[model samples]
Target: MLSVNSVLVPAEANVEVTFTSNMLVVYIDRHSKQVCLLPLDEKRQRKPKPYPFKVIAGLVEAEAVIKAQLDIPTYHLLEDSSFTTSRIVKRNERYQIISPIISEIHRYMFPRYGRSIVAQVAQKTGMQPTAIVRLMNMWFYGGQTINALLGDYSQVGITSPGKNARKVGAKRKNSPFVGRAITEQDIAKIRRFLNKYVLTRKIEEQMTLQGAYDEMLDLEYSTLLVAANGRKKVVAWSDDDIPSYSQFYYHARKYFDEQKKYPRQFQVTAAAYQKDHAGRTATIERINRPGELFQIDETPFDVVLVANRFSITGLCVGSPTLYLVYDVHSNLVVGIHLTLNPPSWEGMRQALLNAFLPKVSFVSGME
Candidate 1:
């Protein structure tokens, strides 16, 4: 039986001696690769999992052996395979916060959804997967409000990247909860419910402006009242989910019956609406004189401009007028006409008459 007096080394040093069994001891140094060991039959039993026990004692013994003879400085044992006490001890926590799905669709996630979801979370807080899973489970269980238990890891902390918002929203999502806005499937589900109950005939065939206003009321009224217009309040939650409007709107009549909180009192009035005349039968000419030369031209146009090319055939009836009046004396065009609507013969005639006004006087000196 080898005792402590026979094998024990000085303080801050290690020495190994065989006593009870064939257990190898290691030791720890101050730096990262630090390992320390003790005999398995140690008086100090290590706390159960992850802490380096036998390997560290073995290292310490090795260090002491070298120190007593060769006297070399002890090296840190952090990188040694013998130091594998915890299997996953060296992995990054940050890598876990951004899940695999985020990395796969980072390019296309923001465009369709509105960029307030995963992108926001990634940009904001360093919450872990367990936390996110817990939050989702909370939502699945009962937290239906979108603003459920938002900590520093939520919307308040991370603002969506505005420049990348489109791509983020457009990214494909397997689940509706992953996105900022409702998906087409959500809309389809609402339609299915509506069809099942024949809601179009009984409730609303087409959503009216008034109904839209009322729906907005039903969505916001309760929340706004609780928040009060001018006051800020702190709302808390443990586990929360989100209430989705896409699914709710199908049965909208159950909540709001066209009673608008924001009333639309539209009064139609006579006012001129501005239209672009760019590339619309442009009149390129120099007027030789007010009455001498008048040019009238028209171009077929389309309402739908695709790939920056407009249709020129009769498929489009919109004719933009290109009328030019030139002064004969200076050969400079004095009048030009362009209109978004179809150019009628009457409009052309009016344009010519306006160009050919009887006593139109140019500044006699400044010509």
Candidate 2:
């Protein structure tokens, strides 16, 4: 561990000690969250020494100079927020330049000494000097020190393509069961077992994947013991022929895949989930006038009606369907019609007439 005084050198000091000139300078590539530690020349440019960096987790045992610069404790670099507070990592390979291009900036004494340093380094590296200068000044400032160059690895590997990018996990392999000797018949049996015993059951009563596997093993044993009347005797196989739990579970999972469009499990139990959880959107139209837009729909009332008021025999029991019409702008009920049967053309026509006709003593005989 370095004492605070040895590692904390004054920026204005012109002393040329062996380590001050030969020691590695720690800088953080903010865009990459990379902590680059490379040797610097007397001109404050990068030397052709080996540059090594690790993710935040790897920084716990880093040199005291690096930890002090990054304001991280010796125990764990991750717990410190001074350097990592809000910095995010860019994950695209396009943003990642070769480490040489990045670490070599320490070798060229640029705008600090003179403009010619940038030109000298650029001509040697075959890259535009302007880009080099921009990268160097990106984290460089007077009295900034080496610590300002530490990248924030807390949010490294961010790849979102918008105003606010976010961190994401590395992608998984295509499939874990790729080399297995699974066949169509094995997959079919697994699907049938899931559909019949697992998926069809109520959510509360559904069997777990392990429970289903055990049951299938029991079924396999029973099949070998008992033979059907007309069909050929079931062949008994060695215990080695049986599929492993992981193999069985993998095939069973296909039926319950959540990524499927309009998944059957959700469709069947939609009523149990809240309607708002469905993430549906509704459109509200803008109405300028009372009669500009009209909305019409029909529904059945809860009460049963006796429709044989004038019948000579007896009362006829029936459910009455009610048609409702409303003005969209004013939200007023303009028309209502009641009929013993379900909604029909006649019901619609009567409802329209009720809306258009004037309700007054002069129009008493209109109905």
Alpha-carbon local distance difference test for all models: 0.37, 0.51
The segments of candidate 1 whose C-alpha lies over 4 angstroms from its true place after superposition are 1-185, 189-279, 287-367
Q: Please report how far candidate 1 places residue 289 from its true position, in Å.
A: 7.9
Q: Write the per-residue lDDT of candidate 2 for residues 1-367, one digit (tens) a residue.
A: 3221112222234332223433333344445434433333344443222223343323334332243342342322333343344332321121232233444554342224335565666676677765654445333421123332343343444333332222134532653322224456666777776766777777677777777777776775345434456554545443445555777877665556752522233354566555545666799878898889888888977876665664775576778989988988899988878888876888988887888877674257555
CA RMSD of each candidate after superposition: 24.4, 23.4
Error of 2 at 168 (Å): 31
Q: What TM-score fits each model?
A: 0.17, 0.23
Error of 1 at 35 (Å): 15
**Whole-model lDDT, candidate 2?**
0.51
- The alpha-carbon lDDT assigned to residue 64 of candidate 2 equals 24
